[model samples]
Target: MATMQSLAFSSPISSHRPHQQRSHTGLISSPWVICQSTHSSFNGQSLQLPQPRRVLLRGSSKLTGAITMMVKPVIQFIQGTDEQTVPDVRLTKSRDGTNGMAIFSFDEPSVFDSTGELGEITGFYMIDEEGVLSSVDVNAKFVNGKPARIEAKYIMRTPRDWDRFMRFMERYSDANGLQFVKK
Candidate 1:
């Protein structure tokens, strides 16, 4: 068995770099150039002059651009239970670690139940902040001649891919009581 000290020799993860570049900062440009021009009559008219040069458009700070990028995520939530039609669901995230989802559409409740039978089970899904799928499924279980199981699936996801999924889930949940369970 290797001791903790021996195992801690080195890890490639330490050298792992995502190569992230700041869009507004100098990271996006290599060797930025600052140009200046001095006006002179026969190179001897430096008696008096105002400010050297005026900056046209100021470069946005990396922080401001990051804040705006962080604010534009569109997320919605919903919950329901149905069985016949396919449940349309969407998953998304609000912030870095928070999560949410939406329902795209749902079927009528009438189609979910019979005169004396187990009702259909239905729900939706959402994408978490990491861009993984978290789903809510309702299953109506029938054993022999009786209904036995009604279950649901609470899914999970990452932060990156959440937004695209949530827009789809928003519709169905709007029609039914949104059964979103956050972890």
Candidate 2:
């Protein structure tokens, strides 16, 4: 077991107070980043620890770029579901990991039942060999009262939550035969 050690800060950290206004969800291309201590690991193996705390990281452009590479995942398209492969559909998440949106055109809108014999709206989920990565209640756009395309938004309010999602994506991509490319 790798011993957990405190990362001493050169400058004493002041009490952190979250801003009342929420930070806008955007890509982390700039030279600033936020961080939190959620998981610990050794030699590429993850170890879940009992201590839970928030970590904020602010440093030079070099540090920012390195952290960005670690957290910023290559965006990907959801090829299809377990039953079949559907093309031209993609999922995008905010760089800060606040939220994600998935959208695709509905070729056969008539097949949609809106409610699957239940009172709740239709929902979409991405499940791999392991389990569901994320899910959201589906909403569709219409043209002349006919469904044209569908979209769903899921939320992950913190960087920690986003990290978990990325782990799921790693496994989901492997099982689904999907590849993420930088463009």
Candidate 3:
């Protein structure tokens, strides 16, 4: 029945500079930065190619009034299907300031010197806030069975905030059916 929350994907900044082909050309130098990633795959098709990293963490200065941003972005997640824990329970996508908006946290790591890309995370960045739709809380733990991935990306500066966060993740995945996990 088109499960996985009616399917929704693309936020790894559009799989290679794809914020509708971003290139606003202010000379590409604006400190309010974002984008962090880790990737690896097999059956999902990605022998290795999805490792993006960039974080300038826009400077925010405005205490108790209205706008208070704090971005600690770095994403890419895998390991799910558990009522409690196992497979590295994860989700961590952070961003603050520049008004781009981002905050999703759900990661579970008790002890993992390194291990990733087991299964679960296949997509990233889904936001909706008020109605309740925020699933991204970056993650990373290297050196395990030899394959687990997490890749993060964020881009917006007009395109109407990337079409208002892609229509609030497409109405939060068509009102919560949930699909948007990619390699």
Number of backbone collisions per candidate: 36, 2, 28
lDDT of 1 by residue, 1-183 (tens): 211110011112222212332222111221233323333221222223233332343467332211111111112122222133233233333454344333233223223344235333324333322232445554555668665433334432543333233332332233222444333
Flag the better candidate by lDDT, 2 or 3: 2
Give lDDT tens digits, candidate 2, residues 1-183.
223222111112221211222212212243333444333321133635333233345665323232231212222123121212222335555654455443433333322443344344335555432335455555667779966555554455555555565555554343334454332
- For model 1, the stretches where C-alpha displacement exceeds 4 angstroms are 1-145, 177-183
TM-score of 1: 0.23
Sort all candidates by TM-score, best to worst: 2, 1, 3
Q: Write the per-residue lDDT of candidate 3 for residues 91-172, one digit (tens) a residue.
A: 2222332223333322343212223335455445332232222244444434565323332344444434544454445333
Give the residue spans of candidate 3 off by over 4 A: 1-99, 107-155, 164-168, 177-183
Question: Considering only N, C-alpha and C atoms within 3 Å, which residue pairs clash in candidate 2?
Answer: 35-55, 36-55
RMSD of each: 22.9, 18.9, 17.9
Task: Please report, in order, the local distance difference test score of every candidate based on alpha carbons.
Answer: 0.31, 0.38, 0.32
